[model samples]
Target: MRKPLLMLVLAAALNGLTACASAPSADLGSAPGVKEGSTPSKGSTLIIKDFADRSITFPSAPQKIVALANGEMDIVYALGGTLVGRPTATVPAALQAAQSVEQVGSTHGLDLEKIALLSPDVVLGNHPLNTKDIPGVEGVGSKMVLTSANSIDDIKKQIGLFGQLLQKEDKAKELTQAIDQKLQELKTTPSTAKTRVLMVYGAPGTYMAALNNSLSGDILVSAGGENIAADYPKLDNYPQYAQVNTEKIMKSNPQLIVIMTHGSPEKVKDGFMKEMQQNAAWSSLDAVKNNHIEILPADLFGTNPGTKVVEALDLMSKRLQAAK
Candidate 1:
């Protein structure tokens, strides 16, 4: 079943750093030493340290795998790894051909029974959402590897680590190198104007603003756009994002507004515009007056676009240039 776009957006909004509790450490089980550059031979015992510093051991290279997150699924596909199960969402175009893969819940929840039935050798997931199911996944004899990515550097590291896990280090290196090169090229790309942008995720009534520290905010800054939401105090309720304040937005007068939505981009943008048009304050906003509004692609912006980071960056750069 394809995952709903709104649920995916809400999942991303709730998965920010502040929404999660501190991860508990686990004991490293008996396993062979596997360093950063060490390649694991098939059937060799391999040990991996996850994002939360917990160690997990695999008795052998994982052939049948389950990925509970979009980013993890993307990495698996990018490295030519097969998936026995994937979250019930629209996966990247490259992996759409694997229609036989079973739906294994979503970022908001997991189907432990379905996952166990798959008899996967390894299960990849992230913190908080997958926290409660970690032991259960291990109980089913599947090695659970938790991963995280909040910045460009973290994304690069994850690509390298996933490559290591799949024994596709060469492919991982090539992908990361290409991403680095594209990012570097963007840095030198000349822009005659800089637009203060308000990056948001939500529907009409409910909205959240991305801060400078968030992945989308970081990408916007890298693409030569300024995030106006950065100046406001962080929301205690959502540290990575802020409540949309009309007064603050009016005062800031962002020149461009970028909406990240999971549903039909046209419908979402139209709904938001309709709501804003009802308010005199919103009508006076610079972005509204100049009509500098854009809807970001859900595939690239809704979740952490793993190997597609460069593509996301390129899109943002082009939009920023056009807005100028």
Candidate 2:
């Protein structure tokens, strides 16, 4: 991005920050490792510890950038960084600034050649999903910064990272503070009987439960829903997700079945519903019998919503409240 535009954005953001700063605040908590700009590199280079725990060094701040995930892409644009290339996904309405960015490929199926030709100074991607592309990006002398967002703190960390990268540290602080206040207001209601919810995320054939550590699960818990998959054994390959346990699910007897799909919502939901119908065991669950299943909005829940996190929390809280 040009220095002038960056300056104008930061200046314009002060109005938002001032408005948000007027809100009440409460002390919350945190997580670790990828704190964006936590490390210092040799000489004038900038060193940042990515979510993968790899130290990514860039000579000065990166200008040409590639974003491989919608969430990270959202953060970049929010921080006033324009992308040379981006992944193929629905740009959240709030991130309309990125709607015109060039599409590269999906996270798992990246067009390495196309990305290489863009000659981005740095590439932003999600942990695990985009870590495998480090070689491809590095081969072209570009650095890859990977991050995971399994919780609100993770989202804040992303803002921090992008804010620093875009040279908008003050804006990042204002953003995090605003989010913190909003979250405190959305604190889970204290109830003797919490809503029992089974949070599921995946494509049609391959389904997984969102365990307590995943972002979806975190959102569930934050919204006063008791996650049935909270204590389930984590999958070795995907610690945040677990293999669906029908027996355990039946035993838990959840009141709500919340779904977040990775593909076409209509197709994914149809496939899931078909599976539930074919298997009477799943069909008989209280959540199904009561018709309390809910498929979250794709832009807000399926993947990370980036700066739209507070909105996601508000939506989840309201849904759980109505169900209760």
Candidate 3:
């Protein structure tokens, strides 16, 4: 999953975790088969059932691509591809490939006018967030592929899709294998008896507990951290998160806290800390008093990590183990 861009209006507070009811019976991440490392066959295009399970047909291997989310941008770049345009978000650290791409605006506030002017062949975006954007993208003569990396499986599926789309299956497999190996190594980490964790997503002064459905929460679990917010009812609009409750936090008494935010990390952290101090019980929570709080790297946590997912998982695993 991404911060969502969610870091989603939880748009940015959480980014990439959702299931679309309108999707087809097929897995959203599946793609039409092609030979490994083979070029697109003549007189044909690629097709994929996006994360929403919608059928998306590519007229040809997209030349002028517009990636509407940072995670997507990172993935495209990781596949040895460049972008014609990208959202105005921080690119992941591993995506060192620079492009002279235009800023088409954020995932939530896409500048359609600018997008149309680009005449992109393909537009990649975060699902559910960009499902409504299909019309706008199509209006610009571009086919949109909306996908998200909610879990390790989701990330691998997305990478495979992009690999097929970019004619870079070899690279995609390499990236996916790294994730597999990392996860295998993680299985060997001695269980910490489920280190209690509270993952909060920040937007301005407001914050919500990220639920198990979120990308961050997914990684938290892989790292052996049990999300105390797992049982909380999800927000109708932002299903990946729930309204943060001090009473709930106190009752859970989590052993670790991880905060993910978009802008001004210090301000958001300070605001949360101020709120915690106002309540003696909240301040005395194990995570708080033991200084077990962690602010995940904005590039890797709040948004979808894409090709940087291996690093993201490694970071989360270390965090959980440290708290243990």
Candidate 4:
């Protein structure tokens, strides 16, 4: 799945954060290493930590923070931490209600001065910004936490790491458990049929579906839907724009079609459906005839999985399972 186009897409926000199928529960049996009072001193302000490290030792817990990446912002919210600042236009809609937080320039081309002026005690950044922004972030006297997540396990670990940093271990535990339970719930339920699905990506003049392992493909599998493109497994095509022959789409005869376009919900819906309707071959597909098309929000259906990803699975399951 393509990353959602934040209209004002700030410069190089980190990329390639992937999600995977759930792992065995036994693998997650233990919590991260940290005692209740092990928090960094409130007085000590400087600290640095890497994503791979299992433990973080901060001089003081960060009370005022600026999140420079989406993952960091999500983690902060998951841990119930107060964010004093975040990159503009990068925050998810779920968090748009937070009006008090300051928008320090875009993470990619960050306004160093605005961030510095915040006097943030800690700055959270991912791989893309870690090296470039570290010196400036540190020069401003704030600690910087560098995080990178490539798989679902990494995402879980981040939840725990942020929990420890924000003293919300309990919240972290609860959210993790919820995710684990949802995966388990999906695992045990048998799908009546592996509904063939096509995850159509939309751009100005390009439209295509993803094979397995991409964000959209992962969600389809998690929801018990099979990607019709799985058979044509082609590599070296990222944000691949291979023109999908309409005849091929008809032949695949996907049981359902999901249109994922990035933009405001209203615009994305009107445009994708109108386009789908215009394509003669697409209009002839079983999915289109049956009206089994779902128009998903750009942000939720775009890149990177999180709580909303889990919800997407449930939604797909319920929709796909309904008798046609």
Candidate 5:
């Protein structure tokens, strides 16, 4: 009788605390035929929505995990959680080299079979992919969780939350404090002048920038530089080109035009820089006159305005000081 009682208790704990091991799916509503938005409560489970507005809840502290989103990977690393697999997407190089980590699939597509083999306890994804449930992430064997890190504040909160889910709450607090302190330092540094800077994004094939609350634009603001296109007021995708007449850029006439290109900085000159250099209309601009055009990695300007924003601030602050 005592043995049977012990077995029942063990089963209950495993049922509630054990992490799921399967692929993501389209209908991640519930364990069986449940609805979306409503999550079942296991011991210490918590549900939260991310920037992409997807629903996710963790059963117990997950150890073996796979991240389907780069931002998700960013948060995981920041919280000091180990990853079992990741999408073979444009995640930062330093993140990919983690010992024992594997690439299950790319962000554009999912490899259910490959992901299944990894036996992930929890799968992480966000935004565009949040709503689309994959087979491996939501099957009976695996549990799917959505991570929300849309804004800088959201990123900070997710750091704490990930720490809780990974049983590293102390590490989460320390990292969050470090990032906050760095951001404050950047914000407090007095600006000599508002250097007119054009933060060009997108691939050469497509060129664009963020306005208002965009991550890139926010970084520019935090770095003590003024975005030449601040008046645009919208955020779009990579390769989303905004056709500014040469006159518009000339009118903005940034003191220093920073061409931010993805991939190699060398590639920056090949795309928009070369075109701008040869154009007669842009020749009169101050940036062109002084050859103040420079290139930087997309990550320094890309990653959501979280701790990475500090890196952008450091880079931009140095450039602004040099321009003086």
Candidate 6:
């Protein structure tokens, strides 16, 4: 009887071991339907509404990011988010260390292959990026967030959006507050004169006028200067700027000419001055006659002024007040 009892006990232990072996394993450190080890438990799902009015749902806050626009990059850096990829050339001096990050491409174009390899969680850009490229970016499992900033109010909104996306609302509030404070100060400062200013962006052989809708033009108006390009017909492909017309410029006879360039300010100014000198019609313009031509600092004007827009406004206000 004792031997029989021992056999039954041994059989029960073996059956228990078999049941334990067949049991399902626990999925450690993973959310339901999410891949194991994919994201941290602290991360929360977020819904982002982009400039295009499209809603994008992020499984979690983006850990790897690619900001294709200078403004986007600036806002991200200001919020203390790390960039996995960025445009190599246009990044500001304060964010120069970002150059060490991967080069995804510029606002003019994107390298789909390199971007794919990086496998960024989110790619931030504007409408200028081809919609056709969306599939290629999505093919690599990356989401694109399109954004724009045509005015100071838009910039503030974008700052808030990025703050929400990056979970950096405190930093965003601080930055926006500082920008608002500066803008308030500008509003209180008395203008020396109501000057008609023409803002132009210059490349080696190309020039374009900033319309009232463009970043510089909007700032120019806010700073108490009149934008002469306000009435210029917008370019078909580039609505923010208008084609440079020497005839119209001569006709406008702007009291101040603000030249914005990404290259050497002196060289750009000399080129415009030389072109003006050759055209007797341009010579008669009030700006040329009064030597009111000024090259805006590249950081504040060459691209979207980003968080430094207040500086641009102050600089323009000072210059406009000082102009004869």
Each model's lDDT comes to 0.76, 0.75, 0.76, 0.62, 0.62, 0.76
Candidate 4 wrongly placed segments (more than 4 Å): 1-49, 52-57, 69-71, 90-97, 106-108, 129-131, 148-151, 231-248, 265-280
Quote the positional error of residue 90 for candidate 3 in Å.
2.9
Report the lDDT tens digits of candidate 4 across residue range 1-324.
123333112221222112212222221334433433444444553232445232334666678988765556766776777788876765677776445678876556666666656778777766554656655555555666666544445566667767767766689888778777877898899657788777776665556666665666666687677777776535454533234556567788887877776555445556666766666677777787787877665555655445455666677677677513
Q: What is the per-residue lDDT of model 6 for residues 54-94, given as tens digits with 9 covering 90 to 100?
A: 55668788889998867788889889898899875756787
lDDT per residue (tens digit) for residues 1-324 in model 1: 334644543444345333444434444542212454445776687666676566566776689989887778888888888899998887678567555689998757877667766879888887545766666666555667776666777788788777877778789999899888988898787756687899988765567888887788888888889898987677896677888777778888888899998776777788767766666788787777878898898878857888888989999988887666
Worst 10 residues of 3 by lDDT: 12-21
Give the clashing pairs for model 4.
40-59, 40-60, 41-59, 41-60
lDDT tens digits by residue: candidate 3, 1-324:
433222213331122223222323554334533422334653466665666767655656677888878778877888888988888766554654644578888778787666766778888887778878766556545677778777767888888888878778889999889888988888887654888999999976899999988888888777667899999999998888999988889999998988999888888888888877777797678888789987889988877888787888888888887787
In model 2, the Cα lDDT at residue 51 comes to 62
* RMSD to the hidden true structure, all candidates: 7.7, 11.2, 8.0, 9.1, 9.3, 15.3
Candidate 4's clash total is 4
Candidates by TM-score, descending order: 3, 1, 6, 2, 5, 4
Error of 6 at 35 (Å): 25
Which regions of candidate 5 deviate over 4 angstroms? Answer: 1-49, 52-55, 89-100, 134-136, 148-150, 233-245, 304-307
Indicate the worst ten consecutive residues by lDDT in candidate 4: 15-24
TM-score of each: 0.84, 0.80, 0.85, 0.71, 0.75, 0.81
Which model is ahead, 5 or 6, in terms of lDDT?
6
Q: Per-residue lDDT for 200 in model 3?
A: 92
* Preferred candidate (TM-score higher): 1 or 2: 1
